[model samples]
Each structure stands twice: as structure tokens, then as C-alpha cells.
Target: MVYIDKEKLKEIYPPNFRLDGDIQKGYINEDGTIEGVFTLDGFEPCTLDGMEGLWNEEKRLFIPNEVAEQGAKSLVGAPILAPTPKIENIREFFEKRYSMLDCYFENDESVYNLSTDEDVLKKYEDSKTSFVFLSIDMVKSTELSLKLPLELNSIFDNLFLNEIASIIRGMGGYVYKSVGDELIAFFEPANLLNKVDDSILCSDYIRVFILDYLNKFLEKNNLPQVGFRTSINYGEVYVKNVGDKLELNGYNLSATIKLQNFAKDNEIILGSNVVNIANKKWKSRMKKLKVNPRKLKKEGLHEGMKVYRLHNLEGRYD
Candidate 1:
């Protein structure tokens, strides 16, 4: 996820900017003045300098217009854009232009059985797509969910999904699916070194962002705290959409999820695939770990796959 200084944003756009819908539908004239809306926090929609881009709902930051353009380009998986009118509306522009995959939360009851939904199957023909897969799960979610009222639990889930997914999108990653407490997402693959850099930066930012966001969330709502464990892998996977629903299936996707089992709270696990493509700086932060598949019984992992954990972020931004 792209990290923006909240105080810096307020200085840039002031307190009156507006954030609405999925995108920040407002105004950014040529003079550098911004007049629009912003989602300051996941649930609170407020006005600010209107920039024609997306917003990271949980973190309450508008994506820079340039970054949004980059995200758009990546979403299309194409090299060049034909001359076209500038897109002012985020949802209208993206929905009309890009075929986005679907996301789910853990408690969702939608059956994954392809045979049961023939109509759905017909709508979402599969295609091979390359992306960097990020699979994350909230630690001790069952106990936490049980402690809260169902309505409040729903609020928490919604908050997590909106913020987390928005951060991914802002960083040019697409959320493929979110089931139960597990969220699966991917970044588009590119031959460009900058794109690879962005993917690693996004992962780093997310690791820090979640720790900070959850603390504030729990404190604001008077709820108990929670933790995150993430595993990232990069490769090709079969992606399909049925109606508005999107799903990912393939070995790479499964491998990413399985790798998460070895992670501890507040840790970011990187699969060998992610490590292979990451820059030297990122690679240096990874420490190799050996896994025993016997410990994962039903997790369906092959024996002796290597995974790495990112470490020492405390002084990273210092």
C-alpha cells in the first residue's frame, strides 16, 4: 500500500476536501488547488482537496492522481493507452474499462463448487493472468468475532475489507478474493523494474499500515486488538469472473495460502517466487526459513518448500 502522511495530506488539501463513493470525485484544477472529497477513515467520508483518483478507505488517504493512472494502466495489462478522454469518475471509469476480480470475507457462505453454478460458470470463462499473490489472515479472529455482537462484527469485517483492499488497489494491486479472515490479492506483473519496486514497497507499507490501523481501530471502537500474518507469492494463475463474482484457482494461489501457515502474528512471509523477483534491497531483508509439511497436515503443501520472513522494519523508515 502507498503510504501518505496524513498530516501532509491535510496540509495539501486542507480540512474541507470531499471523498465519496469508491473514488475521490472532486476537482484538481491546473493551479494546484484541490477541491474534492476524501475518505479520512474507513467509515467516515469527509471533504478535502478533490483529486480524481481512488482512496484507501481505512487509512483515509487519497491516492495521488499519478499513482491512480499507473494503477489503471496496470489493470489493463497493456503497453499503451490510445488517446481518450480523461476519466473523472473512479468507479464509472474502472467498472466500464477494467474486468476486476472478486473478493470475499471468511464468513461468506458462497459455495465454491463450480458445478453448482453453471450459469455463473458460463459468465466467468477463465484466463491465465500473471500477478503477485498476497494471502493474509487475521490472527485469533474466531475468538475476537465471538466476543463482539454480530452487527459489530460485521462492521469490523467491512472496515478491514474496505481499507485493506483500497490500500492494495492504491499500490496497483488487485484484491482477488477475501474469505473468512483470509484475504487474497495480487499485483500485476511487469517487465519494468519500477513495477517490481512498487510491489515490494506496497508490501512493506502494508505491513506497517495494518499494525498502525488496527491499533487505532480497536481503540476507537473499544474492541480488543488483533494481529496479521501474511504470505506473498508471484506467478500466473487462472482468473475468472461470473457475473460480478471473481475467483482465482491454480497452484500458485494455493501455494501462497499454504505458506501463510508458517507465519506468526505481525509477520510478512515471502515465498521463493517473490524473493526471486524482488530487488536487492528487499531481498536483503528476507531471512530463510525451513518448513516441515507434516506440521501442516491438511494444508496440502509439498515437502521442503522454502519461505522467507521480512525483518527489521522498525528502523526501516528511520
Candidate 2:
């Protein structure tokens, strides 16, 4: 009973006959004429002489021949709407509907339908493609968390977190979620020159940037110098939206946590995969830049583990 607007039909339709009414019920003809009983859930293909019922019982969505043709060209498949009483006021309708579903609307206006399994799967798939997972925190955030006054702590968190988030965004990465002092970011492979290269570059840049920034902050505020450590990994992650809330899923989460656990003071640890790619691509450049590249012992270290020790110009660890 939910009739689509005639104008909107063009937007949804593919190149073919201009359909104006329900093609499944034999109402609208190829030339945009309405005939027969114009009752249809949506649209479908019909091999019958005039009109035919081409309902998709599995999807609970109708697809008329005209709409189906459009779908074929546009790759939209079909347009399905849930059967319900149409409310007059759009805002009131949505508010009441979401309330009835125990969902809250956000400023972002992203609608999350909790009833559909496909919706959930699509959400998970989208997240997997768009996120990079990294775990970043001060070398000893627990110790530092207790050292400063409540006000100073708040200031530090705000300043440093905002700066770090901005830096991630500047590097074409998205900070999807943060836990206290730790953050997870997603870097689009398309945005980077190469996924592995960009990941390493960003990781190294952030590590050094945070350290240098903190040193300056300490000097300016007359506080003790603070340092940080980080770990990064790459993998497909699902980004999910629960109403207004968003989350990321992938190896980035587990890899980041593992990296953080293995992170030593004043250093950044990258996943074995990242290290392998970096060693192959940037090994020569690393040597030219005077970076001491050492392969972690295969027997002692897991396969694919490569460690780079930052050193001074004299080849001494700083």
C-alpha cells in the first residue's frame, strides 16, 4: 500500500521503458499507462501477456519488470520497504518508530535497523573494509595517570588525544574508537601510496611526533618529560553502526593489543606482517638512513618478526 512517488521512480529505475505505476499487477504498461488491478508490494519481472505476479517470497519485496530492468543496469537489485502504516509527519513517525524499537537517533542521522540479519552483515562487512587498528598509549599511562592533578590530567588527555586524532586524520586515517589512553584508527588502502608503506610511515611519524611533542610540552609546562609506545597491524575490519554508535572490528584490534603488550619503552612495535613488508620494501632505504635493521632470531622470535632499532648517526642506539 506504500506507493512510491512518481518522480522518485526515475531515480530508482534503469534505462528502459518509463514505468509509472505497479507493473506487477498489470497496472502500468510500457508506455506509462495504468491498467488492471494496481495492487503490488513493489515490482518484479512478468512473462505473462499483460502483467504477472513476480513476488520474491524470500525477500518479502516485489520487483516489477520495469523496476527489475532498472535494477539490472544499476546493480541495485530491488527496492524493498517494510509493510507498515504510513505516518503523515516524517519527524514524528521516525521518532515514534525508533522509540518503539528501543533505538535512539543520533545527530548523524544514520538509521540502524536491528531486525534484519542482512543489515547486520552488511555493517560488519563495511567496517572490515574501512578501518585500520592501532593501539597507542603513553609508555606508562597508568603511572602518569596517577602523577598529575585531576585538572592537569584532564588537560593532558584533551590536548594529547585531540592532537593525536588530528594527526591520524591528517594522514588520511580515521580514529574510530578510543579506550582511555588507547586509540584505534582505520587507514584506507586507497588513500595511502601502499597499505604497508603508509602504515609504517604513519606509525613511525606518530611515535616520534608524540615523543617530541611531549618533550616540548614538558619544557613549556615545567613538567617531567613523557614518552609513548605504539603498535599497528593491518587486516580487514568490520565497521558497525548501532544506531548512533560506531565500532571497528578486525585483526587491528587483537594485533594492536598484542603489539601494545609487547611494546617496550621508547619504541613502536609493528605486526610481523607489517615488518615483513617494510623489510622487503624499505630495507635499503633504512640502511641508507642509518637505521640499524636487525632480524629477530627465527628460533627466538616468531617467523616474520623484524625489529628496527632507532640509532644515532654514529650507529649507536639513542
Q: What TM-score would every model get versus the actual structure?
A: 0.57, 0.49
Q: What lDDT tens digits, residue by residue, belong to model 1 across residues 1-318?
A: 343444565565434232212225544344433344422223343334654445666565655554333322322322221111132443453343222112222444341211222242333357776667777778888888899899777656655555556556666666666787777776655543334445566666666555555455467657777677888877677767656566667888898888888888878888776665555566668899866667644577656566789886663332
* Model 2, TM vs. native: 0.49
List the global CA lDDT of all models: 0.57, 0.46
Best by lDDT: 1
> What TM-score does prediction 1 earn?
0.57
Model 2 lDDT tens row, 193-237: 244454555565565555555455456657656666776666566
Please identify model 2 stretches exceeding 4 Å from their true place: 1-131, 191-193, 279-281, 284-318
lDDT of 1 at 13: 49
* Best-matching candidate per TM-score: 1
The lowest-lDDT stretch of 10 consecutive residues in candidate 2 is 75-84
lDDT at residue 154 of model 2 (Cα atoms): 53
